[model samples]
Every structure is written in C-alpha cells, then in structure tokens.
Target chain A: MDITDNKENMTEAPVLLSVRGLVKSFDGKTVLDGIDLDVRQGEVVVIVGPSGCGKSTLLRCINALEPIQGGEVLLDGQKIEKDGKNLTAIRQKIGMVFQSYDLFPHLTVLDNITLAPQKVQKRPRREAEEEAISLLKRVGLEGKAGSYPRELSGGQKQRVAIVRALILHPEVMLFDEVTAALDPEMVREVLDVILQLARQGRTMLIVTHEMQFARAIADRVIFLDEGHVLEDLPPERFFTEPGTERAKNFLHMFEFEAVR
Target chain B: MPDLGLNVLLKGKNMQRLLSGLWTAMRISLIAVAISMPLGILLGVLMTKKNPVVRAVLRVYLEFIRIMPQMVLLFLVFFGTTGAFGWNLSGELSSIIVFSLWGTAEMSDLVRGALISIPKHQYESSEALGLSRSQTFAYVIIPQTVRRLIPLSINLITRMIKTTSLVLMIGVVEVLKVAQQIIEANRMASPNAAFGIYLTVFLLYFIVCWPISMLARRLEKKWKD
Candidate 1:
C-alpha cells in the first residue's frame, strides 16, 4: 500500500489488542492513570514520551509484567488477565525485549536462545535447536550460536535478545527502549534488526525516545504526557503536524529532525 | 614404642577409626547442608519482599539465629528440651538439629545477599520478557543465585565440620572424643600419648576440611574465569 493509502487504512485496521482504564501507583505516586490503548494486527505502534512519562510502565502493564490496579488488557478480543494471574497461554503470544540484554550467561548462546521453548513450551530438544538456529539466522547472528553473551558486544547481545524473544513466535513484540543503553554506532545494528522485523509486518508496541526510529517505523505514533495519551495519530501527521499542544511541545525534544 | 608411631599406620586400625569418624562427620554435614541451604534460599527470597512487616519479622528470626551460639542451641535441644518436655532424644539427633538450624540461617542470609547484590535491571529485564513469576525465578533469577550459592555452601560445610566438635559435649563419639578417650585410658603408662593422640585428631580434622576448602576455591575461580 502507498503511504497515503496506508495512513487512510490504519484507522480502519482491525484491532488486535485493546486496553482500558489502566492504573498503577507506586509509593503513593501514580505512574499510570486511566490509560487506554489499541494496537492493530501487523501494525507498529510506538509510544513516545519524555522519561518518567509512564511510557515504559504502560508497555509493562499491557504484557501483565507489571500488574495494573485497575484496567483490562484484551488480546484477540479476550481478556488476558483473569482474576489475578496472567494467563500463560495468552502471554506466550507476546514477547518482550529489554533495555539491558538479560541473556543467561551460564548457558551457551544456543542454550540461552532455546531455554524458554524447552522449559516453558516443552518442545523437543531437536525441534527447539532447529528453531533457535533459524531465529539466529533471522537476527543475523547465526555464527555466534556457540558464543556466550559476555563474549559479545552490547549491540550483538541486544540482537541475540531480539532473536530470543522472536523464537517464541509471539503475535506481538514489546520493545522497551531496546537500544537505549548501547553506543551510538551500535544502536543502528540493534535498530537494524528491529527495522528488518518491521519490514516483515510484525506487530509491535515499542516505548522509545528515538524519534527517528518512531518516525521511520511506527504505523501510528502515540505521544504520552503524565500517564495519558496526549495524541494518537498517523506517523506522517503526528511527526509533521501534531494536534495537541502537548504533542507539539513533546516533539520539540526531537528537534524536528524526526520530520525531515 | 619407638617405631610404633609410624608402624601404627601399617596396622590400619587408626585408619578405620579415622575413616569411620570422618564419614560420620561428613554425613552430618551433607545432611545439614542439603536441608538448610534450600530453606535458607527460600527465606532469603522471602526476606527481600516489598512488605515492611514481612521483612521485619524475617530480620528478627535471622538475627536471633545469627547471634545465639550453635553450641548453646545443641545443649538446649539435647539436655534442656528433653528435661523440660519429657522426650527421649539421642545426642546425634540433637547435633543434626542444631547444626542444620545454624547452617540454614547463615546460608539463607548468604542467599539473600547474593540475590540482592544482583543489579535491579536483571529482574526488570526478566519481567520485560513476559516470563511468568515461576519462569523468572527458574530461568533468570535463580541461575545467577545458584552460581554464587555453590561456593558459599562449600564454605558452610567446612564450618559445620569444625563446629561438630561442639556436639561431643552432648555425647556423640566423634573424632575428638575418641582421641580424648584413648588418651585418658593410657595417661599413666604412656604420658606422651596425650600429645600424640591430640595431634592425630588435629590431622584428622585438617584432612576433613582441607579438600572442601580447595573445592570451594576452585569453584569460585572457575566461575570468575
């Protein structure tokens, strides 16, 4: 689809996940309040905001990694959280990559990538190994299977993490500032893996400050201000012409480079 | 008796006693550590919770175990508890109970320190993985905790072996006690046997603890490497 047509069609895309009235408080401070969000299947939705605007907290709540005091997270139009516990069956469909690569250092790179599948999914060793090899290739690190995480560079470790998450074959991937901790030059390599994933039409919900990444990747960009969405617009409109005063002011932090 | 000291090694009687005593001590240590380390790890994990009341209660229990002497604990279990409660109990049983309690409390605190010493980002990253709580513990948090745990546990085993001497006070025939008995019986006829017997006991204790210490050091160095 063309850029203009994609923009017009995004509003009509079927919602794959829906959230409502999410609230989270820590030590008498509200980190998230009355937040609502929707993500369409095969769409990349990037949540952009300044530090401490609760963007990360919002991403966490959606995956039930961080419990919400009040709200609902519906995946495929069904509630993922029932009573108190997060349904593992549902969580299996959503994977997360962190700012710091949490690769298991004790395990070999192949083992680290296959651990979740072997343990959680009870997949056979041969099958899991095959999947891990294919995922390693997909992330452009097939040669590093035998290397330990400590032996790899930060960018390589992050790429390994992306592969680890993708190995689960989740319907949605959550990226929480995945390249925030890397060297400037290394950030591109990590982002390039993500950019490749985007080109494959993987559904993603990302919380990031990389305005250029948000502009280039996101089908829709969400601007959050103080635990609420200030503006939700198509990337072309959101970057070029943000509607709310808060969106305009928040974009100023990106220095208009995102637009050009 | 001039050549008898070295000749004693050829007879193997002393070796038998030494092996038996050492084996008994090792058995006690292995059992104590096996039971206590897991308990301690669980306690340590619970101690780090965000709840203030839970932390305070665990703190009191841990400090009490730490401050009270393990020997006194043995005396209380063997002598005082049997008298106070009208229950028959053996000294060996009491020794196991006291040592396990001591080992557990110390091990638990070590576990807590190791787990907490890990950077907070590690836990956060696991959470970000959408791993369930059990999965997080099994996959991410525990592997790191256990690597630190192995060396610390070996050190605790060594401590437990040395501490088993205190059990002799309540009447278990451990190495030191056997040496004391042999020395007491031959005191008049062989006065220097006191020195010899005690030296033998010292060597026995040294043999028991030295290998474990080496093992602990090797593990620590390997993990570091």
Candidate 2:
C-alpha cells in the first residue's frame, strides 16, 4: 500500500534473474569486466552510465545476445550460455526492447507481436491475436493492429515494439535505451508507456541516459563506469549522494547538460 | 494494297513454328529461372556466413560466373566441353545450363545484397524474442529478404529472357532463328518481310518483358512506404 511496504516486498521476492562475473570483449577489448548483478521478481533496476560504459552490453549479455567470454548468466537458476541447448527456452522468458524499435517491416503490428508467440511458443493463433490486440490497446495503439511498422510514427513504433515483447509474457524485460532514438517530443510518450509497465510491477532491467526517468522509475539505480558497477543505491541516494566521485562528476555533467 | 508479309505469322505452319520457337526460348529461360531462384537463395544465405572457406569458395564462383560472357559460357559448355571431355550436349540443354549458371550468380549477389541491407536490429530483435535460427529465417529474415528481392529478381528474369536470344548463335532454333529462317525463305517473295517480321519479333519480346517491368515498378512503389 505504501512505498516502504512495496520496497520491502520487492526485496522479499525471489531472485528471477542473476548475473555472476560476466566478462565480455570485442576484439580482445573488454567491455564488461567481471560484472555481478541480481534482479528480484517484480523489481525494476535502471542502469545509467556514460557512453560506451557497457550498460547496454551488460543487458545484452544477460539475454545472451552477445557471447560472454568469461563468467555465467543464470535465469531462474538455470545457466544461460551462448549456444546452450536451452538457450531459446531461457531467452523466451527475458524480453528485450531495442532503441530503434526493430519491428518486422514485412509483418503487420499484430503479426509482429504474435510471431514469436505463435511460431516459437506454439500458442494458438486466436489466443495470441487476442493477447496481442489487448496489449496494443493497453499501449493506446488500439486500431494499429493492421498497420505495418513503416506506417507508424517513431513513438508509435516504439510502443508497438514494447507490446511485441510483452505478448510473450517474459519474466524479465530488458529495455536498451528504448527512447534514446526518438525525437524529444516523442520521447515522453515512449517513457510514459515504460512507466506504466513499471507501475504494473514488471521486472525490468533498463539501460538509459534519461536521468530523470531513471530516478523516477528505478527501484535501485546502478552507476556503471569503465565496465564495472561503481554505485548501486536507491535512486534518492544515487541521484543525490552518489557513493563515488566519478558518479558525482557524471551527475554534475548531466545537470550542466540539462541547463544548456 | 501491297502486302508487307505480316500475314506470315498465320501462314501454313509458320504460325506453329514461331509459337513453338518462342516456347523453346521461354522453356530454357523459365527452367533456368526455376532452378536458379532456390539455388541462388541458398548460396546467398551461405554468402553471409562468416566462415572464410565458404566465403572464398562462393566469391570465386560468383566472380568466375561474372567474368565470362554468357555466350562464351554457352560455347564452352556446348562446344569446348564436347571436344575436351567427349560429352555431346544439345543446344537447348546447353542454353539452359549457361543461363542457369549466369542467373544463379546474379541472383545470389542480389540475395546477398538484400540480406546485408536488412538492418542488424531485425535479427537482434528476433533473437531477443527467443526465435530459433530457423524460425528467424522463416519468419523474419527470409520474408523481408523476399520483399527486397522481388523487384530486383523480376529485373533479373527479364534479363534472362532477353539473353536467351544469344542462344541462337550456339545453333539453338529459338525465336530469333525461326524469324531468320522465315525471312530468308520468303526474301524473294517479301522484300518488306524483314521489316515486318522483325517488327513482329520485337513486339513479341516487348509483350513478354513489358508486363514484368510494369510489375516491378508497381511493387517498388507500393513497398516504398
């Protein structure tokens, strides 16, 4: 009922996702160096960092989008590897929404959202369509079922992309800068949809530069720099009294940027 | 009024010869198209593979096909191969083989381009949704690739049909050869027959290729959205 009671219950929820010592590198250049994280059920964790600080890479590694050179990722206690036999099964439980809103251009919005559910999950077509249409309606895209991705605006496409991930009923959702590519005016619309999801108590791991949105939505704000977590604190503390000097300077730059 | 020999198209067995000749040309081209489409798609998918050995092999094959002229390929297959390896090949079979090879090469390259042109996010998002590799190809990659390929592939088909005229040089009795025979046989009777008959042949080729070009343009416009 209250903020403290909700926070306490969220902590009491079982760990739905875990990352232990994740190390990723591209061309022998380390991007995620020995990272450890855990996300509880119905919790929302927002990760914020400077450009190229591995915030996106860390989310990608958890979903097994990028191969982890060292360390392991476990979803619901089952280890997820690059080519693991159960990779798809595990991935089906972790939904991802990208910055560019990569909806299938050839498919209608309804088909785009229902594709994985019908084909991979083997859900019945009518059932998938019903769920997809409901999700579309919830996102304020009620009449967009027959429309293709190209016909939708940037914010509309991003909302459809979110619904496309939601119909599968993923245990954890990963938002990789879902609004970073939008026009400034459209950014609020997409963020509002994400905030609505947050209110529904969806377990999400978000990588974003929207410090204000991050502070507002995050249960715990994580500060990553140079491919390591520097501060993991409540948004109130992380935004106000960051533990490290690097975080303080990062927030200062953001504030200066806001002024400009 | 003096006749320009246009009536030859309806003359005794001449109509039959011309129609059958056109079929001969189309037969070779259509067969080549049928075979090349699937082969090229497979090779195209393979072309995107990161394996160096596969890439090198396909690159060499594509380059070799591109370098040799189609006529030279026909001659090599029909004449040189018979002399060197002692395998007698007919003109129709030779034309089919040459055209198939050329079409396959061009098509695979088109396919590779189409596949690469797809944004990386498409595949990444599909994978993120837990779609298997095959499912991703079937639902996501292949459908979009097919859309991008349609207009280009239709252009390729028209080119192939036009290039079948080259098979007459290799002694294939295709439409061009039929027209030539009719012109020569009736040269004394219809001096104007050359203009009339060749005009008819031009119209025939136009009729076949124009609709295809129109379809391509229509789809390109429709999908441009």
Best by lDDT: 2
Candidate lDDT (C-alpha), each: 0.80, 0.90
Winning candidate number (TM-score): 2
Task: Estimate the TM-score of every prediction.
Answer: 0.82, 0.93
- A1-260, model 1: which lDDT tens digit per residue? 23233444666778988988888888778988898888987789999987899998887788776767888888898786633455676777888888888787777789887877877678898998999898888878899999988889999999998988888788999998999999999998988888788877788999887888888888889888898888888788999998988888888876746565
True lDDT of residue B71, candidate 2: 85
Chain A TM-score for each of the predictions: 0.92, 0.96
Task: Write the residue-wise lDDT of candidate 2 on B167-208 in tens digits.
Answer: 999999988899999989888877777777788888889999
- Report the C-alpha displacement of residue A15, candidate 2, in angstroms: 2.6
